[model samples]
Target: MPKRDRSKRTDPTAVMVRIVVADDGTLTVSVDGAPYLPPEFSPPWRRASFPAIVDAISQQTGRTLRVDVIETDGRTITDFYTPRTPRKAEPQTSAAESSVQAASAAEPAPAPRLMQFAGSGMIPGEEVAVAIIIAHAESGPDGIARTLIDSRYLEHSPTGEAVLLGRISATVCVGQPQ
Candidate 1:
């Protein structure tokens, strides 16, 4: 019986290249990453290896790429290369417009009507003081109205039996439509 020859009979398909992509677009390669080509490789060998290279890089780097075949080692060996594309710039608004918008947003708006009141007394019957305040109304675009009102008072009472009352009144700044 004749002994089998294992050296020259090694399958070229047993050798394979695996590829992985880095987050920053770097690519890595390994033998077990892809299937090896058989000894009877064909003309479309480069095309077949192209997908494996892309898959390897994408898996490792986590980036999808439109891969193009740049060069190859020919025959039993395969080599692949990939280049990254630049990102598009975002649209920007003018500084003047932005500032105007910010200023308008920051300014507080007026209310339609506001009223405030306060009163104070000392020692019961001694004396009692009360005050009332009314704020005028303000109008914004589209007939929106707003206003604020405040009032305060102080008093001294000797008998400690004094009573105080306060009220707020508001007047319309803009006349109502007749």
Candidate 2:
């Protein structure tokens, strides 16, 4: 009789935990950028802050974890890491190709100009769907005098053409390799 491979290692997978902390201290924890669970999972911490997550993960993985927070204009990027040895890559497409496939088409699509040409206003909430609304709609500035988006994003999308044609007058910079 053939023996079953009962080891959990047989179906090993990488878990990408993306934590987006809102300006208001609301945390969005996603596994591979999809909704996984709420921060309220912890009964101890005040609203399941970063330390709460670290506690949970430390208990589960038995490894020390560290998180780095960096503030970029209109965005907060966080990097999480541990001293544990990295997992083996799956036998499939490289990370670079797989990552871009979601952001763009298989064929290189023309970038957008003005970048939505989404002018401005604040929906001001946790839903990422707000971006979708901004993508399809343009608004007059709320007069807040703000540069809400990361400019390079506009230069690389179809919105770039719109920005150029409309004479939107926003700076779109292209970074040269060092």
TM-score of each: 0.17, 0.27
**Tens-place lDDT digits, model 1, residues 1-178:** 9998887653333223443323332234444444434226443233223444455554655433433222222212234433345578867879998999899999896543423222222111111122122222222222333223321111122332212321111112221111
- Those runs of model 1 whose alpha carbons end farther than 4 Å from true positions after fitting are 1-56, 62-74, 83-86, 90-178
lDDT of 2 by residue, 42-160 (tens): 43222224544555654555444444332123444445545355589887877898888766765775553332233223322211111212422212223111223434564455543
Judge candidate 1 at residue 9 and give its lDDT: 57
Question: Model 2 misses residue 17 by how many Å?
Answer: 1.7
lDDT of 1 at 103: 94
Model 2 is weakest, by summed lDDT over 10 consecutive residues, at: 161-170
